[model samples]
Target: METEGVFQSLPALPLFLLMFSIIYLIAYFIVFRNWSPSIRPEASSCLISLSHGTPAVFLATRAILAGQNRGFAASNTVFQNLVLDYSIAYFLMDLLHYLMFFPSDLIFIGHHSATLFVFLTCRYVVSHGAFAILFLLILAELTSACQNAWTLANARKGDVEFAAKLYDFLSPPFYALYSIVRGFAGPYFVYEMLVFFMTGVADHVIPRWVWISWIGVVLMAISVSILWVSNLWLELYRERTKKLEKKMR
Candidate 1:
């Protein structure tokens, strides 16, 4: 089938959203219902994050490897479809979840909005940088499984020993992965886009709105990374100091 024809017939974006919405509903009503009210939504959200994130990591990795010789423009369109599908679903669910359950979480709302805007732009408007977007998706999703697992552990704070041990074991790797991906690579991706826009290296010049949305997405990622990492370090410091003070007694 012609690629464009397939895209038209498949309607990948809406199907993706519908599939994940069903999954999220199942998770919320069936899987996570036994959990405490406050924890259920977050736990369900974590599961949804992993569900999309795992495949994204796989598809993005494959695309990047396969595209090395051919370049992103020649990369498999399937990979692009998968990445955009997973992202659109995840972001939509996240936005809806936040709106319904945690409207005050403005940071996440901003993050989701900016990300969705850019993804939709790439899907419907400019389509030159699919490979870069997929690569960045991989970098972003690699930490989701770990981060959500760690978060779920912390939420069940009654398991103090388990939480502490898991935190200690997971903290280093999570921080490192998050830093490498969002902290460093995210900014690099933004820089490359800016250069492309400014230097006219791309086949077609990206629109100003696309550039603005893309920058907003990257900045949100970097800002969240800084805030989260700083808070993590601060918590670790407090925990260490408490232990130190107790030891002095």
Candidate 2:
């Protein structure tokens, strides 16, 4: 109880920074230090996937356990300190990692920056609708985790026949999951958030500016996801074209 109270009292950004540092250190030790140097990047991503994905799925489960009457809302204590804390921390780390390793990736940097801004606002300024947004954020990560796993495992040296076979097996499901979550469900969640604000349907009092800020952030998230999904589809299309040519030959 005391610990929970302390967590509740702590400011959101500081808490996020603290949690991110911890997760970064752990990921460094697990991925960079211990993994194959060739696959370090993928391993680092894998660590992040497990760290964030596990908890998001767990929180979703807890909500399931709590039963269906619980409509999507801003999290309660356990959800906030446990789930949201870790989430913001992961985003912070992800943002920094991209800045350091792939500085040219401006799109990702912008996505992370915009997301961090909304999270910080929820922590400090907004009083309502955060849980719904956070839930969506984490839910998206669930598919990301699986997608990363598939990518990392596929990035192996192998015979051409075996590699092509593996790629064919894995690519469809991965794209399907990505499409369903980031493409389809993502827009739905954004719509829900919009409705929450437009209809004055939040769980707490949301100031006008806060509402505007939150809606903008959600829109940004949706925009990025659309771009990402488009890229995935393009890759899938090219892969199919290559296979058709090989068959014709």
The candidate that achieves the highest TM-score relative to the unseen native structure: 1
Alpha-carbon lDDT, every model: 0.75, 0.66
What ranges in model 1 sit over 4 Å off?
A: 1-8, 66-78, 159-161, 203-205
Candidate 2: which stretches are off by over 4 Å?
1-3, 6-39, 60-78, 154-167, 201-204
Best by lDDT: 1
Q: In terms of TM-score, how similar is model 1 to the real structure?
A: 0.87
- Deviation from native of the Cα of residue 93 in model 1, angstroms: 1.2
lDDT by residue (tens digit), candidate 1, 1-249: 375576657767778888888888998999978888988998888888888888788967775675544333332355565567668888998799999999999988988888787777666677656666777787778888899888887877575688768867887778778778877877887777667656544444356666666767777778888789879878877987999999999
Displacement of the residue 123 alpha carbon in candidate 2, Å: 1.8
- Kindly report which residue pairs in candidate 2 clash with one another: 74-131
Error of 2 at 224 (Å): 2.5
Candidate 1 backbone overlaps, count: 0
